[model samples]
Target chain A: MTSNDKIIEIEVLRYRPEQDEKPFLQSFKVPFTDDQSVLQGVQYIKDYLDGSLSFRWSCRMAICGSCGMMINGVPKLSCKTFLREYYPGKITLEALKHFPIEKDLIIDLSDFINKLESIKPYIIPAAPRTLEQGEYLQTPRQLDRIAQFSSCINCMLCYAACPQYGLKPDYLGPAAITLLHRYNEDNRDAAKAERMQLLNAHEGVWGCTLVGYCSDVCPKDVDPAAAINRNKLNSTMDYFLRFVAPRGGN
Target chain B: MSKRSNEPIVWSLFGAGGVVVAHTMPVLIFVTGIAVPLGLVSADVLAYERLAGLADGWFGKLFLLVIISLPLWQSAHRIFLSLHDFGITGGETFFRVVFYGAALWGTLLPLFLLVGM
Candidate 1:
């Protein structure tokens, strides 16, 4: 360690099912540089301080979305957050909120995964097109409609930020519904009517209270709140139009 | 498929009332509450006979009814949802009846008064 390297205290919330009855904060003082990220600091802890510490991370960059945690009570990608910002103050690292922690700083994502699968994330083609018929064509404007909603990395930060999901676990949370909207908005998709049924339910878009923190905490600026609200309009129209039109204006 | 929520009916009202409130409430408050009381404009601008004449017209009655009634619906919808946020999960039907019933009452009472006038 160089003389210029500053020491920062990182308190990680630890839970081992066989060993500990409950999760507890374990502090470690680590030497770090201004250039290093919070993820690197935790890496240093694992390398030298405690090998028993567990967390999930694939890419040191933010693209992988695996290193999300509660840093000072805010959901953030630890890889993108610099240690220099919290240099003088102690940093608390905990598993993402509104999820069951699997181990230290690692959350069980089964529920989120199940919700993801239920949304039918892939496009169900408007019509069957054979290889001889050629690929589906979309205009720039058509792609733009669904592009923003497609940026979600499945980091679950928005899920951590959502109070509604925290209250009602079954409420098809932010990222999943946002992805559902993404597919629905795509011009080549034919299953809008099929998908709209999920959104029409009380557990669907109606579950969102427009807390909007989901948009605020998003690393990619996905704006899940806007997607959900837009679908609310669609859902509302569907509710009334179903009585008049045969397909409910789908 | 899960049963659909009846929220869209009230949510449409909430959305409409939100627009009306956003567009008109500030102007209404400024004109009636602030400017008229402060005499920034002439007091006769809101004289009772003149106001009564405005209410007597069909268009004016419709306008008054919309301004008064829609906001009550908006507030009722908001308060109803806020009950969930505040963690009061029981007696959903009771709360819905009380809140929406009050907004309905607000709507009809104005219609009757404006027509009776």
Candidate 2:
């Protein structure tokens, strides 16, 4: 019950871009306290043992959405994984999966960023209006419909848990689809047709095999699976009703 | 996710066929059911008897084998997938060992039992 009992072995996956063709594991013995987080341990390692260690981190808390990595083969935020929870043990740390690794825990999020940009992330009104039209009003139920998905911080942990994304990087991924769901269900927004174009494409919604891991691994409870699946339903209706509905519906 | 999502009409057909085999095969196996949807869904999806039929001269037995194995494969894959999503995994190596072994039995068990040698 004191300051003396502090010893934990940590394994870190390493890659030196110039020297190594691929990545490998490196181990360190860190002195950890009961309250220490995995990110704290990583900080200790980088600060003391090796400045060469690479990983992404911004908010020491889970909010910045930047610090997602794999701990023991499952995607997690280093800021959140407590050392006490995994006590008297060896911890394995690796880069988030399903993304191209730039070095260590850092991955090229260009794919995910591009996906977000393509979905018309903002609201498109049903014909832009002036103050004379008044602000489009919405009921409580309408706000609740798209509210859950809007909590996404874009951490990309869902992509890390998803094997389909790893197997096919072209897949639109969970976060972007969740964003699309946000706008799709927003009563004030009228851009379903624009979002539908991206959702209905070959590399879009169809790529999901419904493995359902994305939702399971999601920290925000955004339920990207439900959003993506619902979008598919939306697209299917749009496809079949193309003749009957307004041609420029979006 | 969407109700309007593209339902793979072909897979749905396979699923229906497998469900039929799943229900009927147990009755056929014992040849005494009053009438129902009875056999094991997992066994039918695997199509283990398909291999048995390839080995045996009996056409009826062969047909049953093919029909039953489909349900077995479909069910097992779905089961493992559910396990994975639940995060109840023993890790990747553990999953590979368990699933690959199950797949082997999925293909070979019926043939070994039905065709002899």
Candidate 3:
């Protein structure tokens, strides 16, 4: 409302399944200050401009991994991206790529969720340790091995950035594979053989052509590309070792 | 149990070829294209008789074979995968045959030529 406050145009891709034949861009001019984020801008539109505008957001600080959208065609957390950066120009917002849009700026994450579940994200402990044995202890070195991959916040930015996943929807994409690697690297976990089955398949690590955009767009610095590449080596060894070793060297 | 991919067999070749290309290709290019052509290194270093002699030896034949063949495999794998990226998803088996078959021929032709030499 201040005299110096600037008004910026936000073109949002809107889809109302009941009414619209297809998604369309609807623009809104909003007044914003330098410190306000894209999320805040969208919120302002929802609160004042249009009540029915829909989007998912929480934490407003990029931790929840929601609020992901294509801002100028790049997958980004709207909460972390400040409006000031895209000031003086129009910003086009759309749902994340390679996902089915549920509504305006909201994507159906069931595919990603199913992929996450299929990876067996939790460690299947080597042996059932009794409470008397206490917590599963890990050395710093052991933790270090899986720590980077463990930082993934389940943000689908990597999936949006992955061309392979975009091309082949069944490709087991970045975040899920990275999470699978995290559990495989855990010293206390002995279910690598079980998990490696998923990775050994064509839909697994073999699907990745190492485009590496997944690592580049990762908000948490979880290099899913590196994780996938490392697993490729592991999978290759497993593939050949099966013929020589009784247990396939799992 | 998920069906395992045979990509590992081809990927192993690709990985090995990539390593060989990364480590030696630059040196090979510089030696032949730059150093010898520019006369920075002696032309005699790559003289025809000496070159043939090197190719005739077991170690040199192995080196030459690796230098020539591995890169073909590497390029074949990369081109094959790139076809997927280019949105050519159909006839994967045909494309695989075309790309990897050429690499196979490249490997065999050199082996036969080197042994005859």
Model 2 off-target regions past 4 Å?
Answer: A129-136, A246-250, B1-117
DockQ of 3: 0.77
Per-candidate TM equals 0.97, 0.69, 0.98
Worst 10 residues of 1 chain A by lDDT: A118-127
Kindly report which residue pairs in candidate 3 clash with one another: none
Candidate 1: clashing pairs of residues: none
Q: How good is model 1 by TM-score?
A: 0.97
Q: Per-residue CA lDDT of candidate 1, range A1-250, in tens? A: 8998899999999998779999999999999988899999899999999999999999888888999999999999999999999979999999999999899899999999998998899989967999999999999999999999988899999999998898999899899999999999999999999889899999999998887999999999899999999999999999999999999888
DockQ of each: 0.70, 0.05, 0.77
Which candidate model has the greater DockQ, 1 or 2?
1
Ranking by TM-score: 3, 1, 2
Best by DockQ: 3
Best by TM-score: 3
- The residue-by-residue lDDT of candidate 1 on B1-117, one tens digit each, is 367978899999988899999999999889999998998998898889988888977999999999989999999999988888877879989999999999999999999999998
| Full-model lDDT, candidate 1 | 0.93
Docking class of 1: medium
- lDDT of every model, 2 decimals: 0.93, 0.76, 0.94
Regarding lDDT, does 1 or 3 come out ahead? 3
